[model samples]
Target: MRRLILLRHAKSDRPLGIVDLDRPLNDRGKRAAPQMGAYLAAEGLIPEAVVVSPAKRTRETWEAIQSALTGPEAEVVPSIYEAPEAALLSIVQTTPDTAGSLLMIGHNPGLQDLAMRLAGSGEKAGRKRLSLEFPTAAVVVLDFEGDAWSTVAAGTGRLERFVAPRDIKIGD
Candidate 1:
């Protein structure tokens, strides 16, 4: 089984005069990112490989999460910046065969759309919540039955879990 983890970048700062790709995460995002990372560690969801968008916000999100996960080095993929669901899938399909699990840090509606399109079933409540909205800092874990990433396709992954910062109550 192959596992795919999709994490939408945390809430980003909307500073005037700054391009979207260069925007960093806001205070809340800074807080939430690590918490989500710790949650992933707690659940043993470490990835064998990671692909992240090069946007500042997404890159910052990865940096924040690294404190909690010892996953492999992340590859910055420019195409992931504003890619749609299909494009995201193409990236997934291209993941190296050596990786048993992969993590992607990116933006949405692409991340949300990809999660919805690939996940056909699993936990009912989580699926329902995911369909509603894939908010900032939200992470969806999907399990694909295929032996290789190339064989995984739309409507074939099972939603193993869907979590967000709100679901975690960590004290400052």
Candidate 2:
């Protein structure tokens, strides 16, 4: 089995003079990012590889989680920034079959779209529960039956988990 974790970058500071791609994380994002990392660690969901957007906010979010991830080095892919679901799908398809799990950190609506597209029948209710609006620092875990990333398809993977900072706090 292979697991895919889709994580939307945390809330970003408004871009005034700064370029959209260069926008940094806001205070809430800063706090939520590490909390997310800790949650993943506590849940023992460390991924084999982490693929992230090169944008500043995404990079910062990945940095917050770096310490908690006991995996190979992360790769910052420029194409992931503002990429569509298809683009994200292509990236996943290209991942080596040897990598059993992957963590993708990027923006929405790509992330939200991807999650909905990959959700299985067992998780239909969870799929409905997912806001079309994917909030910052949200994470969606999908489990695929195939060992290869290329074999991942809609309804084939279960939505094993969906978590956000607010859910974490409520559970606490």
Best by lDDT: 1
Query: What TM-score quantifies how close candidate 2 is to the native fold?
Result: 0.95
Q: How would you encode candidate 2's per-residue C-alpha lDDT over 71-155 as one tens digit per residue?
A: 8788999999989988998898899998999999999989898888888654666677774557899999989897799998766
The lDDT, on a scale of 0 to 1, for candidate 2 is 0.88
Give the true-structure RMSD of model 2.
1.6
Please list the residue runs of candidate 2 whose C-alpha ends up more than 4 Å from where it truly belongs after superposition: 170-172
Q: What is the lDDT of residue 82 in candidate 1?
A: 97
Could you tell me how far off, in angstroms, the CA of residue 4 lies in candidate 2 after the best superposition? Answer: 0.2
- What's model 1's lDDT at 136? 95
- Candidate 2 residue 155 Cα shift, in angstroms, is 2.5
